[model samples]
Target: MPKKIAAGNWKMNGTRASLPDAMAIAATPAGDCAVVLCPPATLLSQMGTEGLALGGQYCHPNASGTHTGDISAPMLADAGATYCITGHSERRADHGESDADVCAQTEAAWSAGLVAILCIGETLAQREAGETLAVLTAQLNGSLPNGATAENTVIAYEPVWAIGTGKVASPDQVAEVHDALRAQVGPEMSLLYGGSVKAGNAAELFALENVNGGLVGGASLKAADFAPIITALAAS
Candidate 1:
């Protein structure tokens, strides 16, 4: 079976004042699940809590370079991060990152001994046109680098329209995508559902076949909001 994980992407949020929430989350018992917190780069080093894993929101494809202000996978590892997110929709859309770029970043994460949480998803328009599976499959094939394994990589499907929008894919939608991903990646690879996941709907989502965990957003900012989701995943 794949490892059950409850990962929180704090995004471009958090500060010294927000450290307490991370601490509180780390204090929560995760049962059989592993809890990871990917805070903003500013807090990744400081968020080395004992029970929770630390990760970087993004990383440069280069190990070390003249790319000013860009953090590399090696740099994240040096700062105590054991995992790094690559190909997040926001990065793909906002920064115009191509699938080739994401594949390079995934390889960089592997070189630095960090697990790459590769994200893939479709926009609402794509979903509306019934092209969700094709889109996801293309992104997965394009963004995932060669030599990826269950141990070194995780797949997160967060629909572009649902992220931070209080919209979530239905259980049927999640099952279809996750099932397809599982077929392609094999049974051992962990698959996570993201986008508007909260305590209210976590259990149902986690209960679905092929859903190993979740990649949370806003709810992750506070332990009070995120802990319940972890507990739900543990139960699943």
Candidate 2:
């Protein structure tokens, strides 16, 4: 079975005070999905090793220092991070990361042996214009590294409109896109859905064909909300 995924993107949230949740989730029995947590770079090592695997919020394209604010992929790996999110919507919108930038970051990720959670999504205007798939295709085509593989690539489709917007794509709509992406990347690739993946709709979403797992945001902050979503992902 393709390991079901339950990944958390901590974004700008979490502090040294937030260590407890990682501990709890690590202890929870994961059924089928390979669970992961991407906290701020400050917490990766402190988050521990036994059960929880670590991830990084973002990583620089180069492997060396002097970039100042940027964290390199090798640094992430050194911190014990197993995965790292690149090209997140926030990075695209806030920093204006071009497709080439995302591709560079993707390559750097593999160089450091960290799986890249490559995020690509369309805004509401694009979705309304019936450009959803085309936008995704273009982003995938431009951002994916030439040496992509299932072991190191995980695509996250986080509708820019729904992220932190309390809105989620219906199961059917999400499935339509995920299935399309599967054909694009081949069966071995894992297509993950993000954007307000709360406990309430997780099981409904998980039931859909090709709906492997989630890249949770706000809901992942609290074990109360994140736990139920993890429970829902257990293979039926």
Candidate 3:
């Protein structure tokens, strides 16, 4: 299996001043685990210098084009990003991004020599209807490209209701989805759990059999809140 990865998604937050938080995280030792910080586009190049793997929040499927304010995968790579997140629920909900669009973006990330962190999950209504596994299966099949592998891709399962809502999926609930994902994608692919991941719950989450690491949100904004989670993964 690939080494565990603890990735932080700053998501429309951070400025030059906030680079210090990432710098602090980079300064911490992450034994046997890889750490990545995906800040907004403005900080990719600067954050790259902090010695942590750097990533982008999103990338346009096309390599380049006239799409105003859109950054392509190649452009992200050029700007010092080693990874790019796609198919996040926020994008799906806000921009109406479809599964096919995520697949194209994943391909674009691979084409640019960047790892694609593909996000998938079910909404509260879908989960309430006991359709979590079914929803995950469909999203996994539709979003992942044919040539995906451990080296080029990572999967993040972020239950829509839990994200930023202080509601986290129980260990058993997380295990079921992650196990199914492992079965579908094979054991080699790295699978991450996101949504309300914090220091208090990090170790328990990382202890699950199939969970490799995390795709952190609000907690990742500060080194103080994020480092303990990385510490937990390292211990796991």
Candidate 4:
């Protein structure tokens, strides 16, 4: 079986005052599931609680140079990050990042000895047009480098329209995409479903055959909410 994980992306949120919440989450009994928290880069080095593996929200494709405010994978690793998210829908949409850009970033994460949580998803328009699977396939093919393996890479499927929108992909919808992802990434690599995953719906989602866990957004900021989700994955 693939390793089950409950990853939280606290994107652009959290401060020194928020460490207590992260600490509280770190203390939760996760059973067999690994709990990861990707706080903002400012909090990455400071948020390393015992049970929670720390991750970075993003990393530049190149190792180092004058990128002017850009961070590199080695920097994230130095900050104690064991993993980094690449190709998140927001990055793709906000920064105009291309599949090639994500591929390079994944490779950069590997070079820094950091696991890359490579994200791939379709917009509402694409999903409505029945291009979800095709979009995911293309993203997977274009964004992953040759050296990717279960150990160094995790895949996350977050429907672009659903992220932070209080909307979620139904069970059959998640299962279909995750099933396709599993076939391509093989059985060992973990596949996560992101986008509006709350405690109320987590267990049902995690129970799916190919969904190893989630790439949680808003729900992750509070331990009260995120802990149950982690417990749920552990039980699943």
Candidate 5:
């Protein structure tokens, strides 16, 4: 299996002042698990100096262009991002990003020598309709680029309804999806669980068979909150 990873996605929520949190996270002993922080673009270069793996929240499919306000994968790499998130639920819902767009962007990330942490999940309605597996399979097929390998790609499963909603999928629920995802993506690919993951529930979730680590959001803003999750992954 790929080395376990605990990646924190700061989203649009940090500024230069937030480097202390990154420093604190970097200060924490990581053991065998990898720790990554994806701060906003404004802080990427600054956080890069903190001695932790850095990532970008999003990137454009193109290497460079006059897309205006869009950061390309190469730009992110130049800024010290080793990984870039693609097809996050927020981007899909708010920006209308499609699976094809994610695939292209993933390829761009790989081209730039960055790993792509591709996000896929089911909406509450879709889960209720018993379509979670189908939705995940389709997203996996469409968003993944050709020639993807365990070293260059990671998958994050964040149930749409649970993200920031203070609701976490039960271990059984998480295991169900992760098991299926592992089967689809192959056993070597690192799989992460996202959405409402807190220190309180981190260990239980990490103990699940196919759950390698997490793509943390709100809890990741502080080292105190995020460190435990990292510890849980390392212990797992």
Candidate 6:
């Protein structure tokens, strides 16, 4: 059976003051689930590792070199980042990153021996045009490096229209995409649904046939918001 992962992408959030919540969540996470917290660069090493695995928001394609403001995979590994988020929508939008870039980053993560959370999604316009699965298929093929494994890669399906928009794909819709993705990735690779995932809707969402867990955004910032969702995933 494929394992469900309740992974939190802190994004550009988190600071010294917010570190305790991460520690707290790890200390008393719900269920026998795998959990990971991706904090910003500054606190990767300083954060305690009681109940969660730490991850990095992004990592440079190269293991090391002179890339200003870029974090290498090995550097993140050394700083205790067990996982990293690569090819997120924000990166694609903000940096104009192409599929090749994501593939290279995935390779870098593998080289550093860190699990990579590979994100793929379709935008609102794409979805409206009935291009959701097609877009996802293209992105999945282009973004992920070849030979990704259960040990080194986890795929996140975050519909761009739903993220932070207060709009979520219905549980059925989520299952369709997730099940297709699961088939695409084989039985071992973990496939997660993400987007405005909240406590109120988490249980229903997770109960879908292929819905595994979540890769939350705003809801992840507060313990109150995330904890219940975590519990819901466990109960599912």
lDDT of 5 by residue, 1-236 (tens): 77699999999898778888899999887788889999998888888654589999899988887899999888999989999999999999999999998999899999999999999999999999999999999999999988999999999999999999999999999999999988888889999999999999999999998999999999999999999998888888
What's the lDDT for all of these models? 0.96, 0.88, 0.93, 0.95, 0.92, 0.87
Which is better, 2 or 3, measured by TM-score?
3
Candidate 4 Cα outliers beyond 4 Å, as residue runs: none
Look at candidate 3 and tell me the lDDT of residue 1. Answer: 79
Candidate 6 lDDT by residue in tens digits, 1-236: 66778888888888899877886777655777788888888988888577788888888899878899999999999999889999899999999989999999999998998999999999999988999999999999999887898899999999988988999998778988988898888888888888999999999988887777889888877777788888898889
Model 2 score (lDDT): 0.88
* Overall local distance difference test of candidate 6: 0.87
The clash numbers for all candidates, in the given order, read: 0, 1, 0, 0, 0, 0
lDDT of 1 by residue, 1-236 (tens): 99999999999999999999999999998998999999989888888879999999999999998999999999999999999999999999999999999999999999999999999999999999999999999999999998999999999999999999999999999999999999999989999999999999999999998999999999999999999999999999
Clashing residue pairs for model 6: none
Q: What are the TM-scores, per candidate, against the unseen true structure?
A: 0.99, 0.97, 0.98, 0.99, 0.98, 0.97
Q: Where in model 2 is the C-alpha error above 4 Å?
A: none
How much is 151 displaced in model 1, in angstroms? 0.6
Q: Using alpha carbons, what is the TM-score of model 1? A: 0.99
Model 3 lDDT tens row, 109-164: 99999999999999999999999999999998899999999999999999999999
Ranking by lDDT: 1, 4, 3, 5, 2, 6
Question: Candidate 5, after superposition: displacement of residue 37 in Å?
Answer: 0.4
Clashing pairs in 4: none
Off by over 4 Å in 5: none
What value does the lDDT take at residue 46 in candidate 2?
Answer: 90
